[model samples]
Target: MFSFSRSPYMTALFSFGVFLLFIFLQNTVIYTSLQTVFSTGGLCACKKCVMDLNDDDWFFMRFNPTVPALLNRRNSAMRSDVFTWWKGLQSDPKKANFSDVVDVLFSLFPDEEHHVVTDPNRCRTCAVVGNSGNILGSHYGQLIDSHNFVIRINKGPTKGYETDVGSKTTHRIMYPESAVDLDNSTHLVLLPFKIKDMLWLISVFTTKHVTSTYTRVRPSINAVREKVMIIHPAFIKYVYESWLRKHGSYPSTGFITLIFALHICDQVSVFGFGAKRDGNWHHYFDNSLAHFSRGLHRGDYESRTIHELLLMDKIALHKGV
Candidate 1:
């Protein structure tokens, strides 16, 4: 004990530090796993997402609002760098002029037939629903159902939460990647990835078996009985590519879906739009009733941004969020 005078207290402190390090490592690993990368369709399994190309557009598409502004001047509103970069995924991977119309088409997309919900009589009211924890125990189901059309985004399993979100779902928007299998009463609106996904849907309903392409998805033969309809992304891309992207950070996948609802529907009542791990967006669950906003974390900044938007009537929120 005389030699170097090492204290037992120091050793105990070192052990505590090691315990904290263990907790930090465990939490870091779990948090990383829970965060699923958002893509147009469920999760992407594509090599290069198109082959021979590697770029992370979805990440850029998330935040950093200025990117759109930089693109606004171009015909397609995409900088040359972006254009050259995502060229492979564009409609005509060969021609630049063919794509010039891409942006303008998005701008004039409303004129396209079947794009706008043109019952001018029904244009005044709209509701934008999210997975926000605020919807639970709100009894907003009847109110939500009362709308001219109900808009749901990335939402699945409409069983117990029907009261808060609404039992009657008119138009549910989703990319095939995240499309939840719904009953015949609900429509599986196909949000296409590129021409391929859209064509795949049509082919399924009309002629071919897309099941050959995907196993996780139910065959079109089965889909016919289920009443599925593929929505052209042009309509959505047009609106978002025009105003929303320029104004805010990348519009939420759900929020963009809601704008389409507003463009076509009237008198909307939002519910359960921004749910979290706790399932509180429409806490009407049977197992446990939770009340927490769906954030990257318990109280992430983006979650707050979305809430402010909801409060401003840009969208709607539940009490908890």
Candidate 2:
């Protein structure tokens, strides 16, 4: 039999070795899991890295949502191109806005020159987190927070639910009604549902003159002034026509935010979207089961589209636990 002595130094060294081994094993498992999801057919795994946006990735034109993508013929045909007053104000444009509420929109944001992407190939990764109740037990917080940009939607709460929804918010997508308070670091992305929504946003800082529209809204909001982003009406229409394929009159805030991720992020991971626990459409923050309108939006169709995007290697969708 081999004789062994238990010295304090030896004990300490052994413990340290064991700790190192544990860390190595943990990292290996994480790598393997990410590889399995991201590298399904020899796709480059580097896309999984959470790096900053660099110059080469400048293929993503920082969209100016203030103006329409197509200004001339397209705008005339579909007023939603710019969400101008010409569009049926009450019918599906959500709300109405007059033509006079213009020229001032540009003044509300940072200079257009500051909008271009300076860093490239930083391997930008973004996580678009939704409010699906399926995320309740999914410990996706750490994974979601690992990304360079974490985009949360509307009122998806991180408090008391950090395990499911990561306690970070680089961006939050909302309209006037669905708006929620944000940390000074978070970007308050306004998805204008109508003309009044745009006016209301500007009014928040300048006049505080426009408050209640279709519903009550904060005359002023708490957010980093420089970080505010408006979803271009043209982009919304593009999502409606190209991706959603006219499945609904308009895309849901969740779906629009997902498409937005595809534009700005090199690698996108989606979490807490779709239905949960017996095909019920419910929010993680609330227990109330809801349903999407077949006329307004085809939730079933959107789900299918998301699956297709996953297969095409466009995005990684975490269907949740």
Candidate 3:
């Protein structure tokens, strides 16, 4: 063994090298932590992150325990109070064997209690794509497709507008009047405001007798029968009463879809909701100017509610350029 005398300079150099190594290690830890937070939507672990209903006092105040998000065979029957309220949303308030329609509906599809199950260790990110013309040229297709779930509302087409609207659709929320054919992979989420809407859904796969509702609807839609989902009337009532505060006739399909995302998704990003830069409302796939005020929905109130949700940091809104 060679005996080496440790000089002061050598000792100092070793100390400095150790300090630099420590600093490098510290910086590495910090960088990794930041990356984790940013990638998981500012959460330490997305699976552990639950939607804090009470995080915002304003939202918590209106949290209704009675309203469930989805409907299955177990909770298909509506209470008398809920039935009275839900049926009033549409013009066809007359009782038309809701139980029978729901029975037939469930028979034709999966009667699972929930469409989506939240996992403690999984982050389900969703993109709720509206058909507003604002996203016409925004080129959000890639970003929309990046989400775990991409939900398209009504008859928003993605064929020619793939650059902006995206081609992937996990869920399509539509009523009878706004019905569109879906590929086998997509979930046909029906927002049934009336018993007839549910009947139309059943007929679409079976009899195809229900040709139209308020407007011409496809007698038979090309969708996966197994993947069909029906929005609970109680949920619609909850959204109308709790979220919208009974604004307009009921919650619009876009708003309902947004609230639906809030229930199942870990992170929700909305796109193409509001009007364009010109303040004119129109579909991204169409040149027709839409009059939100003329519709049954109270467009102004819904817009304000969406803004409030944005301010509360409940959901992220990607208003297109």
Candidate 4:
């Protein structure tokens, strides 16, 4: 019943209104994208400059001068730092033969330039899998195997539970007490608690001479000497001082493994970390056990740090089943 005249001025006004609407829509989309990036850890969607800054070189540069220098087979400074860290943390030599133990420990680590990668195109994607009960029905095996590097902590097994937890393990982290029999291909990363733990690792390969530590360890292990790696004591101290902010006397091995992945890998994804909102801590393989003790390591504080990292987009945490 009503029609506007097709005048030049009227047409121009309509075109101007349409133009403003388009601009408003564009701005709205941009705002929404920015909100997502900021909400989930302020990551730049286009290029992860923050991730680039978290490379091994960055770690070496930032913490090399400070306590807990990044440990590698080659770095003399890191070797010295790790040695001192072990000396300071261990009990009196009278209690244990730590004086001669250092000599044996140093023998296992050869003097060679160790590099994590050789290929320029090697974009290492690492999955740091924990032993939390949440991963029981996750069916993350295929997802986990897809990663370039799959790191498992302590006694987390994938034999029977291969449907949920992947069978692939590039690296297995353990102390002497928690040591598991690893395949030849999988790297055995020794996370020593004391001088005796280090001695236990050395004995595992060569001789069953140094057996008893705080507890009895396996007489020998079945892992390749070429694939054996020792975690630096200084690096452990660094995780305590720098990352967890001295939340507890020391950081948990799982937490340390997560940080270690960040240094070595280009892309890091974490699985089976923390509990549900109900706050129950149990291993995936066993449901009988519950509640992670806060006395040794501040489990709650470490969980908070992980959440903050998730929000900041430092690491991707898959928390639930």
Candidate 5:
């Protein structure tokens, strides 16, 4: 047997050295653990002990719910071209990048279509509904869930709205800016606004971190097999330019989301899109009524656009639709 004896001071020094090595080796774990740290550590780290947690910033961006990314890129050229708006600076995309965006009507979408490689088998019928809180207690929840796949956006909670809407939600769409944790097989609908979000999505999905700090209240990103659907920055710019020419501002978030839905769902029906009561847009959040409160009206412009969609057979009118 080997004899092992040491002074208390020497043992203490050895323990300290081992602890330091452990911290350095487990940096990723430390980084993720820091989310609940302010709430996790029970006490703040010393100024000298604090290390830069660059990953936290990136992880939080994953849950951003406002203005999320329903589209990815053909390549990085979309941004590069837009950034260098100079006439002569325009550069043609390589053949590979050319297919960055392709217009596909929702009616023709394939079940196993993956533009890059191969896509998974997904449901055929899909629906994306926007809740203005205008339909709270309207009992549309069940009706909303009647489709093969139901998609819900921000402020969509089925528990309370089940009576009116139906509780069948196939996918809950959102972004890091507007993400809310819910109990369902909700896909974190990433709608990237800035270049950073796109970069983060590219990195996260590709790196494939099994235990990413991206979320804890939720599990590591599932249903990501859908991959990033490339949306052309040009398309966004084109839509906005057209809108400015006609109206003045770009489509509201709900309408923008609706346009995206129109391109993805086969049969579409809209309920509670317009305000139940006029003028008071901020009704649900502001109104004093508890059970019968209808939420805010998005705006007249979006309603007009939605109406145009209705006329074109793109969407059905209100009432259990």
Candidate 6:
């Protein structure tokens, strides 16, 4: 019979082999877990699409300790600092009974605390379609529609422009000033700049008494009552403070919509943002010249911030020609 006792060399070789096998098994488990966590049918299912929690800026923008994204009954009270900053956005900052307003609003709409729940086993892909003129001839309709969620900003018509701006609208982000009718399937996301804005939302579905804020707004909107969602006042202030760094008077609707996607989506792709090569700013739907600098927002700074986000690989921009 051969001797059973192992030599020092043999023992060392056996231990090394075991160590290598252990490492291989460990790596396999890790890769499998990652696949399950980030699984999706879209481009953002890859490892790179995952937001880095370790990143300070991402952490600050994404995980707000004080502010929640959407307003519900549980988080109805507005923080003092957030209220002060938000109320200053409009001239008519008349104090209204916020709790009472929300109480009636929730009864009309869904009182759910959250809309999109982040899940490790799922990946949500979002397309933020802006109204920039660059998207005119891009023929990105098919590509834009491919996303899980397609968000269109203020009155971006898709009837004639369907080839460029896709017809599929999962969410519409608008304030009362930019309000548009929505189909049954689409979510009507209202970004309230004032307490009256909230009341306007309530009135639209009920009284139809509150028609105008600073200007005349639609007394009744064509939208599914249950599908309506209001952005939290604190969230608006949070974006202004954290993301914009107070660069502009407040974050633009486009910018706020982008940030909203970042919080709820696993992968975000932007379309129709920025000016054309000719350096003229206009909406894709018409020949009218639109100026980013003309509004209350600092469009230049917001553009630069968007570029910074692109540099950070946080979002993919489809610069349509």
TM per candidate comes to 0.49, 0.72, 0.82, 0.74, 0.51, 0.82
lDDT of each: 0.46, 0.69, 0.81, 0.71, 0.45, 0.81
Candidate 5 deviant stretches above 4 angstroms: 1-76, 79-125, 182-184, 199-232, 242-246, 283-298, 319-321
* TM-score, cand. 1 vs. native: 0.49
Question: What is the lDDT, from 0 to 100, of the residue 171 in candidate 4?
Answer: 94
lDDT of 2 by residue, 8-67 (tens): 777788899999999989856755554454332233235442221222222112222233
Question: Candidate 6: misplaced stretches above 4 Å?
Answer: 1-46, 55-66, 93-95
Q: Tell me the lDDT of candidate 2.
A: 0.69
What tens digits encode model 4's per-residue C-alpha lDDT throughout 1-321?
434565778788999999999998985675555445333223322234223433333232222222322334334244665566656664625345654555565567543433343233455678999999888888888999999889999999999988888899999999877888899779888887676776677778777786566567677877878777777677787787777777777889999898888767656789988775467778888776565655778888888877766776767888765
Where does candidate 3 clash, by residue pair?
none
Greater TM-score among 3 and 4 belongs to: 3
Clashing pairs in 2: 53-119, 54-119, 54-120, 55-119, 55-120, 56-120, 65-232
Residue 185, model 6: Cα distance from true site in angstroms: 0.6
Of 2 and 5, the candidate ranking higher by lDDT: 2
Q: How far does residue 189 in candidate 2 sit from its true spot (Å)?
A: 0.9
Error of 5 at 177 (Å): 2.0
In candidate 1, stretches whose alpha carbon ends up further than 4 angstroms from where it belongs are 1-112, 115-125, 132-134, 180-187, 206-208, 212-215, 221-252, 275-314
Candidate 6 residue lDDT tens string, 184-301: 9999999998988888888888888987888999888899998988898888888887877787688899999988887777778999999998999988887798778756778888
Tens-digit per-residue lDDT, 1-321, candidate 1: 453338787778888999999998985564444343322222233211111111333323232212221011232344454443333333532232524434433342322333232222223444556665666677777777766556677544457777777777655666544545555555556664444454445555565564433325534533322345444333434434543433332344555565455344333345655554454444234334444333212323335545644544434455543
